[model samples]
Structure formats: C-alpha cells, structure tokens
Target chain A: MMRTPFEVPMDGLPDRVTIYEVGPRDGLQNESAIVPAGVKAEFLARLAEAGLTTIEATSFVHPKWVPQLADAEELLTRMERVPGVRYPVLVPNERGLDRALDHGVTDIAIFGSATETFARRNLNRSVDGSIEMFTPVVARALENGLDVRAYLSMCFGDPWEGPVPVEQVVRHGRRLLDLGCSQLSLGDTIGVGTPGHVTALLAAFAEAGVGPERLAVHFHDTYGQALANTLSALRAGVTVVDASTGGIGGCPFAKSATGNLATEDLVWMLSGLGVETGVDLESLVATSVWLAGELGRPSPSRVVQALAAESPGRRNVTQVPAEVPPAVEEE
Target chain B: MMRTPFEVPMDGLPDRVTIYEVGPRDGLQNESAIVPAGVKAEFLARLAEAGLTTIEATSFVHPKWVPQLADAEELLTRMERVPGVRYPVLVPNERGLDRALDHGVTDIAIFGSATETFARRNLNRSVDGSIEMFTPVVARALENGLDVRAYLSMCFGDPWEGPVPVEQVVRHGRRLLDLGCSQLSLGDTIGVGTPGHVTALLAAFAEAGVGPERLAVHFHDTYGQALANTLSALRAGVTVVDASTGGIGGCPFAKSATGNLATEDLVWMLSGLGVETGVDLESLVATSVWLAGELGRPSPSRVVQALAAESPGRRNVTQVPAEVPPAVEEE
Candidate 1:
C-alpha cells in the first residue's frame, strides 16, 4: 500500500525543481469559511515541516477586499518562521507594501494582469495603469533589499476575454520583469492552456530575453490541464511550479470545480520523475489530511485521498525495491 | 463562453489521434447503480454522435462478477450501429467471445494483466495461464475477421504488487500482440505513473520492437497523473488513448476519488494542441451533462462542469476568432 511512485528519469528536464507552495494565501482566499489566525499559522508551520522551501504566507490586501487574510499581521507574528524556508507575502499596492514592510517581510509578490478586463475588474485600472502602479511598489521593495516576485495573471486565457495572444502576454511579462522584479510567475488563471501553448509562451519569453531561470508557472486545475502544462514548462527549461496543498482554492466536492494544482499531486509526479523536490510526500499528505479535518471536508487532492485511505500502519511501509525478484512461473 | 480551446500545435506529436471511448464499458462497470440496457445503448449512440469513432460497447463477463454490465447482449442488440464507427466489446474467454459473435461484434477486446497477483485475482489464473487462455480467444476472433485488442492492466503500478517492471509489461504485451491482437493497451489502473515512467515504458516497448502504432494507453486519474502521462505517451508516438465520458467510473463528488481520465478533459488538451480528435466539445459536454443528470450526480470532468455552468445561449457564441483585436488601451 505504499503510495510513492517508482523513480524514472526523463531527459531535457531539470534535475531539481522548486515547488512554490501557495496554500496559505491563494488557497484559503477562495474558501467561504473563515479560518482563525492561529489555525492559519499552524498550517504555515506544517507546510514548512513538510519541506516546502518557498511558501507564499499570506496577502496584505485590504481586509475589505480579502477578509480571509485580514488577520495576516496576527498570523505572521504568531507563526514560527523556519530558517531556510522563504515566506513571501502578496503586496497589492504601496499600502499593502507598507504593511508588509512593517511586518519585517523580506520577500514580497505583486499581482498584475495580462488581460485588460481582469486588470480593470481586479485592480480598477488599465493593464498599463496597473503596471505603472506597481512600478513604485516593486522599486521600493528592491530598494529596501527585499525580493519581489511579480505575477502576470491571465497569461494563457481569460474568462472574460478568450485565447490571449502570445505576443501580448510576452509584452506584459517583459514589462513586469523590467520593474525590478526578481522573477515573474505566469498565471493561467482559467486553466485553458495545453502543452503547446505553454511551450510557445515560454519560447516567447525566451525571445524577449526573459530566461526560464527568472520565470515561474502558476497553473490552475480548472480544466485539468495544470500538470500536463507543467510538464511542458519543465521541458521548456522552467524550474519553479506553484501548487496549493489539498487543492484548497476551490472546493472539489462541490460542483466538481478545482482551483490550484495540488501540491501532493505535483510532488508525486516530480518524485516519480526522479526530480529532486526536497518534499516528504508522506508528511505533506499528513498535513493535508489534518487541514481537511479543520476545513470540515475531504481534501481535493488526489494524492491526499489515495494515501489517506491507506491504513495508518501501512503508511510507513518499506518502498518497493527497484528490481523485484521474478514471480514463480506457472505454465 | 465557447468551450473550445485555441489550437496551438506542439511538435513531436501526431496531428490526429484515435480516442478509444470506454464510457459504456469500463466507465459504468465501477458504478454502484446499474444502468438499463436501453440507457447504455443510447449512451453509445450519443458517443458516436459526439464524433467518437471507436466506442467500447460492453463486456460479456458473467453477471455474477459484473452486474452493472449484465445487459451486454441486450445493449448490443438495442444499440444503433453507426456506419464507420467501431463498437468493440470485451470478451473475457470463449464464452464471452461466443456471446460477442452471436451479436455480430466485429471488434472485440480481451483483458489481461501484467502482474501475477491481478491475473490470479481477476482471472483465476497466473499471468502465463491468462495469456494461454487469451491465445485461443484472440485466434478465434481473428479467424472470424474481428479486430482483437488486448488490455494489459497494471502496466504501470499494481495495488497489490506495487510498481510493475517495464520489462515485465513489455513481455506480456508482446505475447498478447503475438496472439493476433491488433493493439495492446497499457493500463495504469492505480494511476501512479509520471511522464518519465511513461516515456521509459514506451521506450522499452519500442526496444522490444513494438512501436507506438500497436499501443494504446489506459490511465486512471486516481493520483491525477493521467493527463500528464498521456502527454508523455503522445510525445513517445502513442496515438490511441482510453477515456470515459463524464469520468463516470469513480464519483468525484464522493470522497474526491476519480477513476478514468475524462474524455472531455482529454479532448480539451488535444484540441488545444491542435490535434484533431473529430469531437465537437459542445456536443460532448452536453451529452455528458445529460448523462450526469441520469446518473444523479455531477460529472468529474472539469470541462463538463465549466461548460455546463454557462448559459445555453453562451454555449454557441461564435468561437473567439483566432486573432483577437487588441483591447482599447488607456494610460
């Protein structure tokens, strides 16, 4: 009943990948139930214990806009920050950046939009206006010796606008990178992309002089294309992938909709591919199970469900040997 | 609101793929509710109408073993046989083959196992015994001018035996093909495979002289690796994939466990990759929506859910043009 996949390496992929865990901020943002700051702090600690080096802790957006993380300051003050683990908080504007700086946050992320409709709806500004708005925020963060990661949302397709063009996404991505951001995370907000689209987008970014080393991919599982697109991104030389533990952003049990790609599912693939992710699959599954109990529903993650179903006694079973003895022949 | 994905062709993949729709057989087999023969027949007809050229009609296993598909003969007799569409039935042994022949089945499949544990548990025989048993069945079917397909289950991982060796799967696959099976489908029953494992297994088969033309992949989504694995298989030159409409075998609304890779999900990715599947996404999603209502649950497919939520008028809104005019810019 061992849940680990057999290691089989493929060519043209990085030997190791950085899994950017986004459960606390992106995942909990979509939940209808409000979690206590103490519980959120515990979740962050558990994520660090599960070997995630870069966990997006919480967003500093106004309480009126994102009430889920309204207690962000309380949670950050209470949470035990692991030494080597980086907890990056999302800063929406100068006000959010001020709050993040006040909290002594060293790592921050700014959310941008590739589509005009999303930019207007989410940020109340045009795409160009939003970029102009983030200019000072990113510059100030860099000036203060903080790392800034910019998220370009709707890079693949938009719910309001369909089939985003490759060149337009590249242009916006390059603009965000030029804003003194350390890295740009491409967001397929609607999860409508395929492998080819992913490859083409990365190629465009490369053509624009934004190498894969400075790019991360944040894919949703709304259409179940997240992992396949991730595979394509890896083959195209990208090394950072974003995932949410338990796929918590959208409720899988209700109406069969999913949000972020589950961290456990992503880790399972990375583990089977012999890619070093520095994650303990067992510990991650355990954390998801414990969190699911707190959420009052089963986890949306397939790996969490599969592994949690096994008896606790079998959880620590020895891994299957690479070469097993042949079965007895019967003619 | 168009459900279609924008075509973005990827390199190293076939321009066209044959999807072996298994909804009528493998999909309903695991459901606790028993669908009527007439309903199964209608389902097959709808699948054909949705542009699936190859549909697995039903299985002739004993009713005692699979009461769900007990009406296989009735289904075959009642179902409309579309011209140029292949309706393959599962014939477990000579008895099953006799039933299929009685119904004038021209395409038939035999299920085998790569692991000794599954062979014994499922077929009451060892791996060798099962192959020996299939030898005459395949031979008889071929002699009758029926196209024979062999299913090698547990090719990736076995629940009881754990990760199966690639060589073992290739050997059994070769034996099945040698018995006159036109195609051998490798099944990841527990869905523990990754892209690397998929590539390695296909490479092993190619080294054994069985090219991708003679191979199909049947992947479950238990651990959510099915789509990613399918991507790898396609990259390795596989053009046939097995999927179930609505992902009906396992209920996603119940405990978040998924069985087969949903046809809608597969078609979404394939369509996005510019691979022709001949399936109209709208018609397919509508069919799945109707079937889900009949089954008294929502579909596990993300595509189905997303599209079904759209207003009826929006479903047919002219597809977003390949090149959209840029949005009005405001600085």
Candidate 2:
C-alpha cells in the first residue's frame, strides 16, 4: 500500500445528532394497508432495539379520515416503551390532544401548514385558522407538563402554490413556536427543497431568534431531495432529523409524493461523517427488510435495497458474482 | 394570507453550475444490455437538446470489457453534435486514445482508481500500476491539444476496503492532476460518501493545492447519498457535476452499487437553489422517460418517476386520486 500525505478533517460539524424515527406513525399513516396494532408495536420495539432514541409511535386522528392508523390508542397500550427512548404521537387538535392524554402520552406533535392552500385542503382551515386550531392544543399540552413539537409543512414548496416565499414559512413557523411548542420541525412536505433553500430557511429562522437548538427538519424523498436537504440542514447547525424505516408513506392527495427520508440512508451519511448517531446500521437494515416483507414490497430506500441484496441468501438471485478470472487477487 | 418578515437570501452560493452528462458513457458501460448505436446517438442528442453543455459520449475501450458501449465509434459517427456542446469519450489506454484521435475527438477522459482492491478488480493493476498506465495516455492526449479529464474512482469508500482514508484519495487525485488532466472528477464509486466526508476530502484536496474549479464530483446513489454529496460539493465551490440520465449505471464489480446521481435530480436541486444550470428540467425528464421506455424498465430517478407518473396519460394507471370527502375541500 502506498502511504499518502494529508488527512481530511471533519470541521464545523455537530458532534452528535438526534434522529426522530417517524416510521411507525408518519410512515404508516399514508400506507394503504392497515398494519395490525401488534405489528406496529413490534416495529417500534425493533426500532428501539436498533438504538433509536426518539420514535413517533402513532397519531390521534379520526378513523374516518386516516383509517390506516385508527388503532393508535391500541398500539400505545400494547407497545413496550424503552426506558431511554421517547415516543411522541401526532395530535392535530384539542380533541386529539385529549385522546393522547387519555392514552398517557408524554410527548406530542402538532402539525401546521405554511401554505394556505395545503392548510385549506388538508385540514379544512386556512393557514391562520389552522394556527388558531393548534393554539389551544399546544397551550393545554404545555400546561399538562408535556413536551410538544410543532411541524410546519410546506416550508419549501406547495403543490398548488408552487414555490412558497420564505417569509411566509418563517412567520408560520414562529407563530407555532409562540404557541408554546418546544420545537418546530420545518417540513419539505412535497420534497422540493434544495440545499440552498434549506440553508436560507435556516438562516431566516435564525434571524427570527429561532436557532437550530429549537428546530428539527423533516423531509420527503418526493424528488430525491430529502437526504440532500438533510445534509444542508445539518450543515446549518440542525441536530434533529426525521426519517422513516423502509421509506414508507406517501401523501394520498399528492400522488407524486414519495416516502420520508429513509432512516437507513440518514444513518449511512451520519456514520460516514463520523457523527455520533448511536444507531446500529445492520440492525436498522434488517428491521427495514422485515418491514418491507410485511408490506409485500421492496424498500424504496437505496441503502436498504443494496444491503438486503448483498446478503448471501438474496445475493445469488439479484446479483451475479463478478466473472473476472481472479488474476490479480491481493490480500 | 398573513404578512410575514424575512427573505432567505442565497448567500455564499455559486450563481451557476455545470453538469457533465455521463449517461452515454459511464452509465451505459455498466448496463447489462447493449443499447443500439442509433438509440445511443439519440440519447446523446436529447441530452444536448436539454441544454447539457458537456456530454460523455462513450468509452473507447475494447469490446470485450464494455460491450454495452462497444458501439462508441458508431455512436460518434451517427450522432448530430450540437453546436457549443462538448462530447467527450472515455479513453482507457494508448490504443483507446488513438481511436479517439482517429475520430477527431476534442475531449477525452481517463479513469484511475484510488483503492488497490478496485484497481486490481476493475483494471487488473495496482493503484501505482494504473497511474503508470495512464501517464503515457494523458501525456499523449495533452500533446495532441485535446482537453483531458481524469476520473479518480473510490475516493470515499471501497467495497472491500471500506472507508478509504482522505490522504490516500488526495494523493491519488493530485497525481492525476499532475498527469496533465484538465479536471479531476472525484468518484464515490461505492456510494458511501456523506456530506461531511465530501467537505473533509475537498479540504484535504485544497491543502494539496487543488481547487474546486479544477474539480468535478461523481456520486452514486447506492446508499441514497448521491444528491446529498453533490450538494456538499457544490457548497464547497465545485461547479461541475457528473450525472446520468434516468439514473442509469451501477459499478459492475460492486454489486451494491446503484445509479449515478440522476441529471434530472441534480437539475431539480439546482433550479430550486436559484442556481443557473441552463438546463430545461421538463425536457430532461421527457428524455429520461423516453430512454426508460427504450430500455424496457422504469427509470431509477425519483424525479423522472414522479414527473412521468404525474402526467395526464399515466395519472390513472399508477395512481388513483384521493377519495377525500368534499366536507374538507376548503381550497
């Protein structure tokens, strides 16, 4: 081996990152099939076993609206809570918040939209109206000594509105923070976020007195910009990221929507960057493979697919060994 | 709509970027099926029509090694070269260089490996021996007044070697630059590169007196980090990127390899960032779709898949519009 001069230094990077695994709630909610409560609980356990510190368990929503996660309460009751892991459920309004409290949920998330069109279409309210709806829920949760996270969707681009202005997203995001939500997750709901957009949004948020410490990033892989946007967010000083196992979930309304950023893919980047994520890559890959099998589909995540295909059992089926006669095999 | 304060200014970003379209050469070379010469020519023309300034036409390697691109000469002869568009071909050795010269090729690229394992497996030589083999070819091309590029493969990770040290990659890359190549394209051959690693390597390269202006980035999406790595490179001031149309091409020796960073995906990000790439995104998407049809498979690019599925003709086939009740349709 030839020795070389000069080593690459990892500079200006956060030493640790918090991955908010949303596979159980956000990922499954948009899935067509209704995963059994037991199966959902098992998936959470597997995620915890793989060393994820934060996992969104399920959502408190009307069965008539999101039939896939109607059994959220049952899953909460049946699931084993790991001692060090945090399981937050999505709560849309006061009624949902009440239901979550009834289920003994300690952490909760409230979603708001940055775009007026998405707010009206998805929540039957204008952007201001949706904030009005979330205000009471956030106040009640904060009073109950519960941690609340606010998710501001369409922070990048809106399908109907096209490219959203940054000022609008900042105003909407700050309002949610003012409502007493501890952290605000900027969401690239349609996955149209570019790295430059991410940096600009983060800068705008910073200018508004909201720093990375009080922010998280949630991205969709709709146009394959999720991971890239995540990288930009990380560089912008964000430490919290939201991702899905097996890259499941696409918006029903937006047929072009793909899954959230895959947890395996995020782990791969973090691991290579020497960032301390504390997540086991191989175990995460296995869990995604198992979930993909249950869904009766291949994982949309490139990492999961590559690792699964590399295993001995599937290797022969998918990949033929290189036919080069080993004329120069070196140890 | 509520009035808000703040604009996310695109600060410290390059105003323009150059995309090196490699679908015709690097992409097709790894494909299993040999694309017809006429179709290859058409693909090249389509890329140019989409405003790609630099297109790698084909590899001038022996037919036995890269049979998929064995029609290199035919492709060059049959294709209508767009004015102001540079079509470069990969030249493996002196013989390949002679073939390129015979065809009046103005631009040529030579590939070298950073890791010993890949060098032996892909080129049947050690890293040193591979560089030695390229010295004469690069010198000959430069002497003939042709623009030459050197592609340094596995700069980030190797299938067998795992994470290659940054020092090793910088040394190899600097040597290639010293060999009279105009540009050095750092390739993450196994797709294990993360944003942090890209920064670190670029920093190491800078320490070795190599600037981003003389560098291009080639990333694979095997682990879904290609776009993310590309973003990092762009942020690090690298203006040129290598991408494959329809996200074609996976390394043959590396079974876990996936497609190159899709040109459509790159253009989508560049456009969103307000960076000028001079490429028409819809035209690029159409070309990828057309090529996918010719290949008898769906494109691996998320942008191509999303845009194609969103069109009116394919809308009813892959996606069923949401059946949400009008009670919530406030928009």
Candidate 3:
C-alpha cells in the first residue's frame, strides 16, 4: 500500500523561540574532564556569536559541591560579553547570588529540582529546605533588579521514582513563578519522558494557571524523544527552549545522560518548520564543529555533522535537504 | 503544592512491539575498524541470544561500496540460526540475492531511497529506476520462498530534495509493497524528522491500505525525536521499530550522522512502559559496554553507562533514584 508523506500542521506555534544556552553550567557540570576557564570562555563567546540571546553562563553554587564550576567567578570575569546576550548564572543561595551580582550577571536562573530526592541529592537539601534557602536569594536578586528564571528539574520523570508526579512539577513551578521567576522551565532530567507525559504534565501545570507564555520546555535527548516531545510542547505553546551548543552538557546526577538537545538540532527543527528562533543553523553548526575539535570527538549534535558534510565548502544556509529522517541512535 | 506523579495510559498499549534490530548491518557499517567475519558472526550470535527475533544481519552490497561488510557472506554463513529469529540481509541486486540465499537467509530486505537525487546519488538511479531494479530482486527472492522487507529511505525528508512530497513517498511505498514486500520501513535519512511527520506519514501509509502490522518505523535521533516519533507511531498502531544497539551506526549517505537509537535506550523505554519486547536490558548494556571498549569509545547508549555506573559491579535494574530526576543529559 502506498503511504503519503506527512503534512505538518503548524496552525499555532510561537513566532519566536527563545534558546537558553546551558552549555557552560549544565553542559560542563556533567563532563568528567575539567575544562580550563579560558577554553570555557572561548566556548561561551562562540555560542553568543551564534545568536543565542541568553546563555546559562555559570553556576554560583558552592565550588566544593560542583567542582566543574569552581572557576565560575573567573569564567564570568573573563568572558567577552556579547552586547545583547543575557548571561544568566545559577545561584543557589545568598552567597551564590552575591557572586553573580558582583560579576554583573544581570539575569540569573535560580533552579531547583521537582523531587525531594533530587533536591536533596543535587542540592543537599529537601525540596522545601532548598526553596527556603532560595526564597531570600530570589528576593535579593529581585531587589537587585535581576531577572530570575526557575528551573524545575525532574518535571517529567525521576531516577528513583519512575515517572514524576505532575502535581509536584506544577507545585515546584508555581513556587518559582510566584516568587517572580518570570518564567518556569520544566525539565525531563533523565530523558525518559514521552510526548504524552509532556502533554499531561504541562496541561496540569496550565490547569493550575501556569500558561505556556511563561513556560519553557527543557529536554534531554536520552531516549531520542527530545525533539518529538519538544514538538508536542511547541504545539501546546512553549516559546523558550534550553539547549547547548554542540549539545555540550549533561546532568551530572543522571547516570546515562546525554547533553541538552543540540542547539544546532533545535534550530534546525525550528527553522525548518518556519518557526522563528533567531538562530542561524549554519553558524550553530560551525560553532559545534569548532567545539567538537576542542572536545576531541565528534559532536553529539548529528545535524551539525550531517549538514556540514552535505554542504562541503558551501555557505551555512545553502539549500537544506528537507527532512533528514533522524537516524541517530544516541541513548 | 505537591504534584502527583505522571503516568501514561499503558493499559491500551499493543502487546509485543516488533524489535527490528539493525545492529548487525547498520551497527557494523559505521565502525572504522573492520570487524572480522568471525567477530561479526559472534556479534550476530550475541544479538540473537539477546532474544532479538529479527536482526538485519548483513548486507550483500559490493564490498568496494561498503568495505565494512566485505565479509557479509562469511558472516552470514556462521550465524547461530536461533529459532524464531528472522535474520534479514540487505540484497541490493540479483547477485546480492544469490549470496543471501546461498547463506540460507529466509528473510531479505531490499532498500531504495525515495527522492531522485538520493536514488541517483545513493543507488545510482531515479525513484522509478530503483523501483524497477528492486522489482526483479523482490520477485527472485519471493520465488525462492523468502520473506521480503522493502526499505524506503528518505520517505519523510530527502537529503537533496528538501521536504519529500507525500505523493512521491506513497508512489514509492506502493510500488515496493506491490512488488511483494511483506514489510516496509520508512527512513528519515538525515535524522531531521518530527512526530507530526511520522504520524502523518504512517497515517497516510495506513490510509493507503498498509496496516500497522505491515510497517516498521525507522528513525534517527538526529533531532532526538526518533524514540518519541516511534511512540507516536506506536500509538497509531505501527509496531515494528528499527533500532541499533549502543547507538553504534550512522547513515553512509548522511554526513555527521550520529548512531541509531541505542537498543538499550529503546528497550528501557519499552520495559518501563511494560511493553513486552523479550530482550534483557542488563545484557544489552553489558554487550554495548564490551563493544564500546572494542571500538575505543563510549557506547552511544547512555543507559548502559548510567545503569552500570550506578551499580558499578553488578547489573542492577533498580528503579532510578526517586529524589533526583533521571539523568537528562546522558540520554
């Protein structure tokens, strides 16, 4: 029997997608090798050149806790700031916020996982305990005129508990949003989430008044469902997506985590759908390729290599072969 | 406010999802080191032992074209011949068929791309031209009492021809199925596909008279949508899914292409959902880890390392930590 090609119905999609680059913090945190601050700054500069409006530059968490970002202050101090790019660093408490404010981080992301176990394990405190620790930080950041974005990790699934409870995700999201988070990004930490799971979770969040306008969907490409799940979220009206250039980072806590969905891959999907993301696919690829060499292996972003390979010597935005049915087998 | 845990309506899922393991052919093809015939045979043997009833063992395409499978005949001859396991080899032409039959392969997969540019660049023919070529090959194999599976590449998107039209894909799928293909697998060659694309294509295929039972969904994780797309297809009643273990393969025709969906990742999703695939997750991880060592890189399947790392010395299936979210970046 003959099957016709799929017709994508883009009836309601966000006009412009905000790509929050998390390469510096989320990306480097999971890597076992300690990247030098100079190299990390170089990487951040390249990402900014790729037209990323917001990059999760660094985390102000205790250096002893996250050894990867021990040079956080130095990295922030040395970066060649992109004029319009908002570099949001994660600050866990008053001390962390103090560091970011001192370093002139105008926008800050105050993050917390949904589950008690993750909060306890990752932040070394229970969910409420971490939030209590965060309240003053949020108040101070807001008082200091900083824009705060709360990350609710394990929004979809947990490592200890199979599937995440929606109520928990929404509850966590509400706290962050109520605390003037401006935006709440729901994360599927382990990448075990499916579209249905995403739909249900987000719908629940919406029902409780967390509309898509103030929501961003952060996904891991663990199960190869990141894009599909992202598509579902897009149709459901998510405007902001957190991604990494060259898909650099992972969740240090998740055992088999891959990097965030490659920004190149995300931009490719968005640009292909005619959805506006303000990201140049070609520059993103060039940036990823450069990072790949620095990382000493091929990048996790399959699109970067495929597009670069196909258009050898051609400019970045050459006629893209439509719809390369994703063949990547990354777990 | 505590959010309740999210859960999918698993009761309605289909029983016994089809496992189309392409590791033997697709997996080995991308390896830079040439795996000896005995090693390839050993690989296939291990695959069958993992209870994979359907394995695309080897391709009889010219050795000059794909040097990795130069020993296709020798490898097939030494397969373990596990009962109920359908070992299909790629037969591009009549000569290839003779070789596969010589090795006593009862099932064979004959593949061709949908777009003219790809057909010409990949198989050296037009869409119509390749179909004409495959007809005789399909006929010969059917006459030899062999089951035939037609592989339609670039069904959703073409590498050269941007977005492939539904009308064109349908025409190709109909022709191949008409020529006696018992099963047809639609591929997103460059891994640049979405669920809307998959759902639309599969729905069109079903509308064209092909039932879910007669089709397989082949996706790449290029955009990290392969597994999520697979789930959408499964929801639409399609069962067969082609995945590679440890994500150890890439499209020869596509550049910077990543590995296929790690079989371990696919199986983990399936197992979590209670779908009976009949493959052991721990053993799959072990095999992927061992193979990764042989290949001198980490396995693409993050599940293997995550699970292995958590347990360290034992293959444990303990549920992920309830507190921390499942590792998002790893997958």
Candidate 4:
C-alpha cells in the first residue's frame, strides 16, 4: 500500500501553512439573510473541530452596516472556545474593539483599504484617513493584551483606481504592522489579481522587511485567479491563507466580487502539495455542505459541489443538530 | 491615464504563452445538445478572430459516441479557414484519421489515459492497449504531413486509481511523445492536481528528457486548482495551455469532473501577468456569453460571468455574426 500518495513536497515549497478560516465572519458578512447566532457558533465549532486553528468568528461592525453579523457578541458568547484555537472577530473602530474586549475576545482584526477610492467608498474615509482610524484601534487592542490583525483591502486592483501600485500596498501594509498588528492580510477584494501581481507584491514586501510570517493573503474568486494568486503567495513564502467555507462572501465594496477562495479547495491543494494545514478535508466539506443548507443556497465551492454530488447524503450537518437531544427512554 | 493597468510581467515568468482553444471540439463534445454546424463554424471563426492561433474545431470520433460533435465534417467543410491559424481535430483511430484526412485536416490529436481504469472505461482497453491502439493513429497522421498531439488523460488523479504516480505518468507521457507526437497534452481529467504536483510532474518529465516545450497542460477546474496548476506549469516553462471557451466540457469518463479551465479566465490571468496569449479578452467573453445563451445556460467562466454582469449588451456576437452581413445601402 502506498503510505504517501501525494505527501512529497517539491523544493522551495512550505512544509506547512496556516489557513485562517474566515467563513464564519467574512463569508457571511455579505449574506442577505442574517444567520442565527447559535448557528454561527455551531459553524465556528465545526471549523475548529475540522482542525482549523484560527477561525474568524464574527464581525463587530454596526448592524446597519453589516446586519448579517449583527449578533457577533451573542455568537461568540454561545460558542465553545476550542483549546489552542483562535477566534478572531473583525473590529472596525475602538468602539467595536471595546465591544469585542467585553466579550473576552483575544484576537481582533481591523480593516483598511490600500486604495483611496475603496477606502472612501467602503469606509467613508480616504486611504490615509482609514489608516489613521485603524492606527488607534489596533494600538488599543494590542495594549489590551489582544493580538491584532490588519486587513489591507484593494491590495491588487481597485474598482475605481484600477491597478494599485505594489509600492503603495506595501507601504500601507507596513504601516499597519508598525502600528502593532501581528499580521497584515493583503486582500484582492475585486479579484482582478494575477499570480505575477501576487509575486511582485510579496517580493516588494520582502524588500520592505515585512516577512511572510507577518503576511496573510485574502483573495476573492471574481476572476477565478484566487487559488493561482494564493499559489504565488505560497511560493513566495507566505504561510497564512484566508478562505471561506462553502466559498461564501461577496465583497461589500465590490458588487461584482464573487466568493473567497473556498476552504475545501484550499485544503485540497495544500494536501496535494504535501503541505500540512491541519485541516480535515472530509470534515471541512461537511461543514460547507451544512452551511450551504443553512444559507438556503448551493455552495459556490467546486470542491463542496463535487463532493456533495459524489455522496447524496454527505451534507449531514443538518441531520445532526448542533445540540444533541437528551436520550429518550422509550420501550 | 494609466498606459498599462496590467501590463507588467514578473521575473522568472513566461513572457508569452500559446492558448490552444478547445471549445468547438472538446467543449461541445460533452454538451447534451448538438450545436448546429453553422454555429460551430462561427464559434471557430470568432475564436480565430479573437487572436487564437490554434483552435480544436471538431473530433472525428464516431457520431454514436459523441452526438454533440456528429457534424464534424460538415462543420469543417463550412468553416472559413483563417490564415495563420491551425485547426486540429481529435482522431480516435486510423478510421477517424482517414476521415480527418478526407477533410484536408492539417493537424490531428489522439487521446490515451495514463491510468488503466480511465483507459479501460474511456478507450475500452488497458493503458498499454490504448497506447498501442494510438501508435498507428499518430504514425498515420504524421505520415500524412499532419501535426499530431497526443492527450494523456488522468495524469494527476484517477477516480478509480486514487493518485497516479509521477514516474508512471512520465513513462506513459514519454511513450506518447516517443510515438512521434508533435506535442503532448497532460490532462488532469479529475482535476485533483496542485502546484506541487504540477511542478513535480514537469520536473520529472524534464529529467526523462522530455522538456516543457513539447508539453501542454489540460486542466479541469473541479477543485478550483486549474489556474494554479497552470501557473505552476507556466513557471516550469510549459507555454502551451489548453482551455475551453465558456468553461465548457465535462469529462465523459469522470462524472464529477467540472469544465476545463475557461479560456477567458486563463486569458485574464495571462494578460494580468503580461504574458502574451494574443487572445482578445473582450471578444472572447462575448463568444462565451453568446454560446452560453445558445446552449440555454449561464457560462461557467468567471471572466465571462463578471464581465457580462458589468455590461448588459457586451455579448454582441448575436447582434453581429462572425460572417458580418454587407452594410445595407439606403433602400
């Protein structure tokens, strides 16, 4: 029997990668129907059970802005905190950070856009103004003994600004890191990025002394280049990848944006590359299938769709509820 | 105004690539409805006009097997052969090659599988048996002064054989190449490939004295790794990429297999990377959208979907057919 079918790594590839699962928060943020708080908690728990160490649970953005994740505090409170797993929530401002801290959140993320047009349209501030706003929010979170992650959106292309310069993105990313954010996730919100753009951006970041350890890649599948761009980042030594289960999430900024890189798809690639992501492929697929049912739509993920079609009864997350019923003694 | 929004190529990446369009033949072969011969010819003409130098027009396979492409000879006969464009068709055996020769076909392709299961199911023979069957087909095609391309399917994963060995695939690939094939397209029929797998396979092939110049990559987007795998192959110096317009063509052998890498999506990535493919993105998207409407379904190509959503009337292929009508004078 072949013990390792695709368990051999090629030269210059990472031995292991960290998949920062963002399905619970970013994936559902743009959803039309607000998911129940308990359901959100259950989804996060399943993701953690599938061996994902970091799962972005929910966002603390105002209900008017992101009604889908309005029950952030309630979801976090009801969630079982898996040991050794980190649940990061999106914090837009100091007020959101304070709310997250009140819920005992250890990890929080702030977002800014690399392009002025996106920052102005999405966050109601200029690019520099958005950075200034996030500066204090990140500093306060770090001071409160929480790990901060800064997401620099529109890192690749801006719907209004067109192609963003590599140097500009690196500058904003470095600023966030300097402001005490533990990690900086460069986002392709419009999904117009190619592998060459990713390679060039990562190389520029390395030249600016921002190592891969401090960088994560968050890509959208609008142009279907997410996985390819992720590969470019991986080859450039960036270990952290942000993906959505069931390939959920449309960018609130870019209306044409599709879903993020599907977690199942990402896991498939990593497993094939012999890169350890500590993710259970079967379990992850189940979670996506379950989530797809909850969302009342078919998943946009090719892996989820393919696997579901393979086994008719595979999406059994609904069959087994989040809470088990007490054994009935009937004879 | 930005002179080149996405015209910068990265270091160590291919500056140019050859996109072998496979929509008319491979793409439509799996369709349930048979496209009209005129439509097929129009599609081929539009593909050539959109700057594709090589288009797989039709397959000479028996009509009983692929009813969708049954009008292969008629489509070829009615097609206006563009200058500097090579139109190749699939020839299953000596009979098929003879039929192609009767139509004055200049280039032909023969397909075999690297795995025995796919070989038996697809060709009704073992891997060796299938290769032996194709040896004469390829030799005959070469004897007729035709360029022969051998497609080796299931090079990455087999539905029955979990993960094919890299060395074993290389051996099969070498056999096809040694059989006087001008080019060999390694197919991931099940779409279970990663960048590492692609890199490793290409490297192994190089070791076996088969360089990337003699190879083309035919990937399916089942797990959303098609573009990534193509990127890896491109980085490894394999410049020929096989893609289907509108992301058409599900493998008949693998039920779970999705469409091949969409030519529009591939062109988007290659264009963004500043890799010249000579394909006009707008015109190709229009072709996909028009064909999608003709097929009574939405296109699976992300670029086509995104661009169509952005422009309501961008799919003007219906407005102006490939053979434009002479401008009517005022009556």
Question: In candidate 3, what are the lDDT values of residues A43-146, reduced to their tens digit?
Answer: 88887887788988887666555677789899988999989889888877787788788888899887788888778667777888878877998999999999
Candidate 1 accuracy as lDDT: 0.84
- List, for all models, the DockQ compared with the true complex: 0.32, 0.35, 0.21, 0.18
lDDT of 3 by residue, B1-331 (tens): 1112233534445777978999878777766667778777777778877878898888877676577788877777676788888888888887778878777889988887777877776676677877888888899888999999988887766544667777678778888999989988988755667666666777788788878888888877655557656776777787789998877875444444565777877776676555778897767777777777776766666566555455444432343322121221110
Correct interface contacts retained, every candidate: 0.41, 0.34, 0.19, 0.30
Instruction: Count clashes in each candidate, considering only residues at least 3 apart in sequence or on different chains.
Output: 0, 0, 51, 0
Residues A161-234 of candidate 1: C-alpha lDDT, one tens digit per residue: 88899999999988999998999999987778889999999999999888999999998887889999999999
Stronger candidate by TM-score (2 vs 3): 2
The interface root-mean-square deviation of each model, in the order shown, is: 8.5, 8.0, 10.3, 18.0
Ranked candidates, highest DockQ first: 2, 1, 3, 4
- Interface RMSD against the true structure, candidate 3: 10.3
lDDT of each: 0.84, 0.79, 0.72, 0.78
Chain B TM-score for each model? Answer: 0.93, 0.91, 0.89, 0.90
Query: Per-residue error at B136 for model 2, in Å?
Result: 2.9
Query: What's model 3's overall lDDT?
Result: 0.72
- Model 4 agreement with the true structure over A1-331: per-residue lDDT tens digits: 1112354466787889999988888788765557898889889889999999999888877676667877877887789999999998888887888889899999998887787766666677676777787788888887889999888887887655768899999988888888898899998876778888888899999999998989999988877989988888988999999998878875433343356888888888888788899988888888888887898876778787667665543432221100000111111
**Model 4, clash count?**
0
Lowest summed lDDT window (length 10), candidate 4 chain A: A320-329
